[model samples]
Target: MLFVRKSYILPTAFLLSLIYLLFSSLPPAPEALDIDDREFSPPPKQNGGQIHWQKGREKHPIKSYIPLPTAAAPLPIPKIQHDFPSESWYRRRQRVNRQTAVKQAFEHAWKGYKKHAWLHDELSPLSGDNRETFAGWAATLVDSLDSLIIMGMTDEFEKALAALEQIDFTTTDATQINVFETTIRYLGGFMAANDLTDGKYPILLKKAVEVGEFLYSAFDTRNRMPQSRWQWTRTAEGLGIEPSRNTILAELGSLTLEFTRLSQLTNDSKYFDAIQRITDQMEAAQQKTKVPGLWPVMVNAEEMKFTDPRFTVGGMADSMYEYLPKEYMLLSAQVNQYKSMYDSAMDAIKDRLIFRGMTKDNQEVLFAGNAQAGMPSKEDLEHEAEHLKCFLGGMVGIGAKVFRRSAEELRIARGLTDGCIWAYDSMPTGIMPEIFHVSACDDMDDCKWDEKKWYRDVQRRLSKGTSAQNAQQEGKSLVKTHGLAPGMTDISDARYFLRPEAIESVFIMYRITGDKTLQDAAWRMFKNIEKITRTDYAHAAIYDVRDRHTPKLDYMESFWLAETLKYFYLIFSEPTLVSLDEYVL
Candidate 1:
């Protein structure tokens, strides 16, 4: 009996030791908290105040995802000069009504896309058909994600989040991927959505990682310069790809913001390193170009040289300049080079590219024009302006506020914004054309409209060649039919692609200046766009903004929802919803 008791005691002691070891290795149970307490609990801080991942589902402040730059002094709050009286009850009601109208417009478009064009890049709003312009990865849905969230469309946002899981970033229908467009529309869309949601949805970041990795493969060259258009299928087959010798400025330079943000989110420096290399190359080449301060539209990526001398703050070169100030803010002003670069470029732009247009009403407004190599004089500038260039107003406005630039900069911003507004108001349909030519004023402040000079200018172009004569005739016919405001010469491109640049500036100006007139302008523009562009299915682009009976283009771009309607909705929203101080948009 004694021997049996000793054996049982030994076995029981061994079992107790094993249980103690197992329990010691496990994590301690969390302190019990009520639902409210749990919901309000702060996330664990890691990576210098960045939110550390916690188990299960949780939401954090937006600053945790996109933290304000702490490396430098915080920027000052913009002193917005309110130009209107305190908001009356009637005015408040009207603004709320407008916000609802914009929301309804969004729902109409979203419903059409979900029903007809799910998983497609765009929707043929008139026909309810799917169009694949950007790899059929559901560009519209992804791009519209943050916008839906901002508008508080909870149901639509949930549905979008579910559909987002269906996208396979590993493959696409297109053989060649446009690096620039995909980066802006897809990669940017994903990052913004994730940031705005405070990283509650992990799938959004996962998909962003997949897409970012795929795009990073484009930088596998000897110089680490990316191929603006990448052929991934060839690369996947072990056949190498090379960066394009000729790439546009925007395609190469507009990637810093997205990649830098990706690195911040994932704690991976590789993505930031890739874009930093590009930024270094650009900084090195800033003064070496034909124009000392501005980069040309076409650049030689292989040699890192500017092959084209033509520069415009419009199409191929706009966003590159845009990203400069934005990246500076995004990095919390840790990089002073961007601010210097932006200042130098803006100085050059004001001196060479910006010109004053003499209006029929004898009003003077600023327009950003084009510059050619070897033509440094004001006389050599192109008086043509594009709808795309209208964003400069907002860009400059933000720069002035952030960089604390001179009051002259703010004045120039207001003038540039007013110029675009005048263009819209002067048009027959109350919508500006894609591109147009205006008469330049010799003196910005003291110029009068000259009918004789306008006729002579037309005749001089007509005498140049038969093609010129035909162009003049076409311009004349458009003028007669559409009724041009004086000091306007011709309509170069009449189509409207549901552009948001003009309204983008209007929105920014409203936020920066607290100008009631800007809102009025936005309201007018929205009403005109809604009335003219709306269809039974959804809104469509019009072939000609001047023609009331213009045919709908059957397609609605992702920006129509992502940018246009978002700007419209925000213009009428509470100013603090997406405060400029808090967001780069």
Candidate 2:
């Protein structure tokens, strides 16, 4: 009994010693993560401040510009003037509101895309903070940023700028040449936003120049192509990666716009020339077209020259034109030719495509009137998104500058964006579905369920993260309820439209002319989404609160919400906030 007792005590003693040793060997707790009991500062004296507006006010040229030392209006608050701002400095609050809604929806939809680190071989969009994703996400970020600066939200905009810092675009990394979209989306938007925000958040011009140089050097003689994909050839260490062929038109259009923007920012003639080369390439390419059209999505850069006209022309063609006319205005004096081309193109597009509405069954597309033009195939989703982007971009360009679109054109654009929003408002609570394509199947006569099967199939594959079962169910439900050609479904769910691209156009209207309605809209959308805020997958935004395990944040895609929301918040805000106008230009 004594021997057993001794053995047990010895074993227990040994175990206790080991435990203490292990505890002692462990490192101390991290100091950075400590949540200390914080101390609060003393409250300030509430009433002793004297009213001296003159102390803060700078002397101006006119005596009328100066104000007396005392507060100008009621106690505490001065009488703030809401006067007519300069024509160029016009504010678009109404449009900015709608753009905010666009961002809210865009954020939820964009989270489904894969990360760059995952796709080590293929082009990953979310490669860096400037861009983790390619053009699609970048465009969303810029669009959102546009609204953000307008709304007077500097905190969020700064966060976005911080996120962009992750993308280091150096000439040494040849394969890492996806900086073009960042320039167009982040840099350009920042330049414009900084201009609007009183210089609080300008993109560094030196970085822009460095990025522009990288972009300029990448384009080869093969129709001014930028390397879409690249990898180290193992030929040399310092020389960097070898280039892979295939550059998409959509990206090229993106590059062209950046070049144009850089030229404007830097006054470098070379950027203008680089932009011209893109148009030259567009002219060089050939593709099928029913009217003034061309495919914007390039599958095979060498073999396919803008094939599939209906899907491509809307965004790619229009985007290409974005930099061209502006760059032309800067380069040569023949502005008349540019104006003429726009007019001619407008006529062609009006005649060939675009139906005003579907109020009448005849306009419902398919039988003889508007519907007879054939539905888009599953392959055309990319095409449609591109066209939608370009169409909106072109209209904004044309309406804002070219020909000063008739009151009718302005009305049309307003109607178009409004219609898009109304469609989203009417959509089913959760996800937005793919489009209800017009009936154009040649074999429709043989199959009764072509509409349901086609769209259901298309939506599942295209709408980013939707499940196949859900897509089919929605497709069948839409077809069963509405049936055949010309029926309407919640196509607003398309990540392309859900983003703030259209709202950017609306913001243009507000900017060109001071409109308080835009400001009201921006405020309303912010409040609306704020109510819907829910955390998912460790990210936060105006999320689909119903879903769990999806925080729904893609830095690139969410930039639209992050930036544009801030833009709308800034311009109409109290003067105490930081200025954006100085930084953007």
TM-score of each: 0.84, 0.53
lDDT of 2 by residue, 396-502 (tens): 33333435556555554554444333333333332222232332233312324344556664455335666776886666655454422223432322322223443
Q: Considering every candidate listed, which one attains the maximal TM-score?
A: 1
Measured on C-alpha atoms, candidate 1 has an lDDT of 0.77
lDDT, candidate 1, 75-173, per-residue tens: 443444233456889889999999899999989988889888988889898888889999889999988888988999988888888988788776765
lDDT of 1 at 127: 86
Q: Please name the candidate that would achieve the greatest lDDT relative to the true structure.
A: 1
RMSD values for the candidates in order, in angstroms, are 15.2, 24.3
- Whole-model lDDT per candidate: 0.77, 0.38
**Least well predicted 10-residue stretch by lDDT in candidate 1:** 1-10
